[model samples]
Target: MKLLLIPDKFDGSLTSESFANAFVAGMKKSGVPFTSRYIKATDGGEGFLKVVGKYKPCISIEVISENPLRKPIRSYYLYNKEDNSAYIELAHASGLELLQYDELNPMLTTTYGTGIKINDAVEKGVKHIYIGLGTSATNDGGIGIANALGYIFLNDKGEVLPPIGSSLRLIKSIDDSHVSEKVKQVKFYTVHNVINPLFGKDGAAYVYAKYKGANDKVISDLNKGLIRLNKVVSDKYNVHYNDVPGAGAAGGAAFGLKSFLNAEFLGTIDFILKLSGLREILHKESFDYIITGEGKIDKQYLNSSLLQSVIGLGMEYGIPVIAICELLEISKEDLKEIGVFDVFDLKDEQKNLEYNMKDTAHLITAKTAEYFSDK
Candidate 1:
């Protein structure tokens, strides 16, 4: 049998590469003869650079950046010399993982730290920048990044807003007079797999702010803020981005990138799949099963572009799809509807998360052997 492995990282446990390796080992141990294609992938949120570097020539450029609270931290981005392009993972500076649970409030958080990273690259003369936005902790729109690059947000009193979510509803106007010429010239791309709009029922604030630590009242206020910011942008620029498919991503950071930097958008899964030559492979080869997964299997996985993309490919090529994850939480009916023929999870019910994560490779190997032993 020929297997196509393009699994996602198992959070703290395995990268897609390592996941593929363990699965293959299981196949070998099961005495199943197989040929395989292993491609390392990311959603372009966390492990973006590592996947990009596998196919592109890039170097890590380290700099001092700020956390979502405006505190300083060390971070880095990938820079490709060939086209003077830079790939920045926004979570590196503004992700939820950077904050403690008590510090998770989005109202006080800012994307200013991510802006600092962008500004640093701009200062270094990079012409194109790709910002990966996901797992964010801020709901300030893009004002934080704009502030770092010389745009100022002001309240009705003409006092500069602090570039936080709490200030969103208070925004009376914007000051772009001091925005640098270089910042204006560079091309920007918001990279992720989000399709939500900027600010309404399904917009950034209402859908994502709560997860970023906002209560009902706070989510309401944050939504109002985003509304204000959109109105201000429309009045000033005679433009609208509030309804754009990806404008609501990263707590409206995608909105900011577009309204401020004139950014375009890219889907991480599509980008990685195309760049990895997987589509090209479809021209000459076929697979018995295309394997893919993330940390957990649930309803979100069913709606996800990652799993959907794999399923689409499997459907197009008449191949079945299988998945391996750290845990399985989706129903068999859901799997059947998605065209997944089989699923495997390596979770050790009696073991703690730490132990399971540490022993993931062994677990995956054993599980894989079990799944294919009869076949």
Candidate 2:
């Protein structure tokens, strides 16, 4: 029997590569006779570059910046010299993980560090910049990023506002005269997840503000700021950004990029899938079972569309696909309807998830080996 195991990272527990390694070790120890292959799939979130790292030559560029709490943080960017292309993952700077529980205030956090990365890349003379926008701690609509690029947001008093989302409402004028000339020549692609608009109930504040420790009043203030910022940018660009797809990504950072930087948005998963040659791999291999897993399996997994794509590919080849997840909260019928042959939970027979990962992995591999060995 042949097996393919492709999984995303288990969030904070294990990287995709590490998870693959663990699964392989368990398989070998259990005397599995089947051939197995593992792939680290990226939905254009954190490992987007590494999945396609071979296609793009990466050069490290040091970027001096600050995290969400204004703390010093030294970051690096990936530059592809061939196309003069550079990519920066937002998690590297000013990400949600960079902040402490007490430091997750949407009104105070800023994407200034992310801006620094972009500026550093632009100064290197890159023509195309791809910014992966996810896991941000700030709710600002990219004002802080523009501030780093020399755009000033001023208040009615004619004083520049501090870099924050809640302050975007007070901007009486936006000054772009101080921006570098090179910025105009550059094009930007914002890699994102959601396709929601920039404002209203479905917008950044109401959708993601609570995750960053925003309260009811803070959410209201943030939505107001986003509305005003959206108007200012729409007027400047003469393009409506209120209902644009992906504008709500990264706490409305996509909206800010659209209005301020003239950037286009692409779903991270679809982008990464094409770049990683996943289609070619799927066509080239024939497996008895295709095993895929994530940290959790819920309604969102069915909605991701990337998973659906993978499942569709598996079905086209008549390969059985099973899911092995940390948590399985969906109904069995739903799993079948989505083309999942079976769903297994790693947390179900164990009390401590972290402590039991190794043993659980061993058990899963052994079970797989026994199943194939009998066949």
Candidate 3:
């Protein structure tokens, strides 16, 4: 039998690399003799670069930048030379993980680090840039990034606006004169993990800002800033991205890229699955069963994420797919609706949240191996 040990990170518990190893170890201990394949599947989240490492060596670049809450931090971007492409995972620099619960303020955070990374990629002469827009800690509507790329935001008094939400309304003119020549030649792709527009009740600020520590007033400010910034971008560039699907991603970075750089926006899972050649792998191997999962499985699993892609590919071969998650939130009917034959949770029956994660992983691996070997 052949199995694919493909799983996203367990969030707070394990990284993708660690989960892959533990899963394979469990299969071996269960005495399931099978060829196993490992693939990193990041749906524009923090573990994105770790998964991409399976395919390429990442080029590291350093730049002085600020985190989501405007605190200084050093960040890195991964460059894929073979494809002449660069990947910017915002979480790697200015993500929610960079701040504490109390520090999560959308009103003050910015995408400045994200912009600096893009500038570094351009300087490296990359022709294509793919930005993974998930786990952001800001609501600046991509103004911080555009500023780094030479799109100056100014007030009526002709003074440059500070890189924050409160100052977004001060914009009167945009200057693109200093934007590097390479920027015009490169193609930009925004990989959005969610489908939210830039400005509306369901827009970035209203829906997601709360998680970033926004109160009612802050959310109002964020929305206003996004509205103003979108207009500025559209009026100057002759494009409107405010109502575009996925425009609200990464705290309006999605809208910013679409309007300013003419980037192609795609579902993060779909793009990663295609790039990883997942379908080809499934076609090459005909297995009786496929086991797939993430650190946790919830209603969101119905979306086109790593586990969903695995199930879809398995169905093509008439194979049953069993999802093994660190935690499972769906009912049996819901699991069926999502295309999983069965769902397994790795948590101990008697333990609470503080259960030893390593032991739990081994237990899950053993159970998975036994399930296949029994067949």
Q: Pick the candidate with the highest lDDT.
A: 1
Model 3: residue 330 alpha-carbon error in angstroms? 3.1
Report model 3's TM-score to 2 decimal places: 0.85
Q: For each candidate, what is the lDDT?
A: 0.86, 0.76, 0.76
User: Where is model 3 more than 4 Å wrong at Cα?
Assistant: 28-33, 155-159, 167-178, 235-238, 273-275, 300-305, 308-320, 356-359, 366-375
lDDT by residue (tens digit), candidate 1, 204-276: 8888888899999999999998999999999999889999887988899999999989999877766776668
In candidate 1, residue 259 scores what lDDT?
92
Regions more than 4 Å wrong, model 2: 1-4, 25-33, 47-49, 52-55, 287-290, 300-321, 335-341, 353-375
RMSD of each: 2.3, 3.2, 3.1
Tell me the RMSD of model 1 versus the true structure.
Answer: 2.3
lDDT by residue (40-63, candidate 2, tens digit) is: 566545665676575567787787
Clashes of each: 2, 0, 1
| TM-score (all chains, Cα) for each model | 0.91, 0.85, 0.85
Candidate 1 stretches greater than 4 Å from native: 301-305, 348-358
* Residue pairs in clash, model 2: none
Q: How does model 3 fare in lDDT?
A: 0.76
Candidate 2: C-alpha lDDT: 0.76
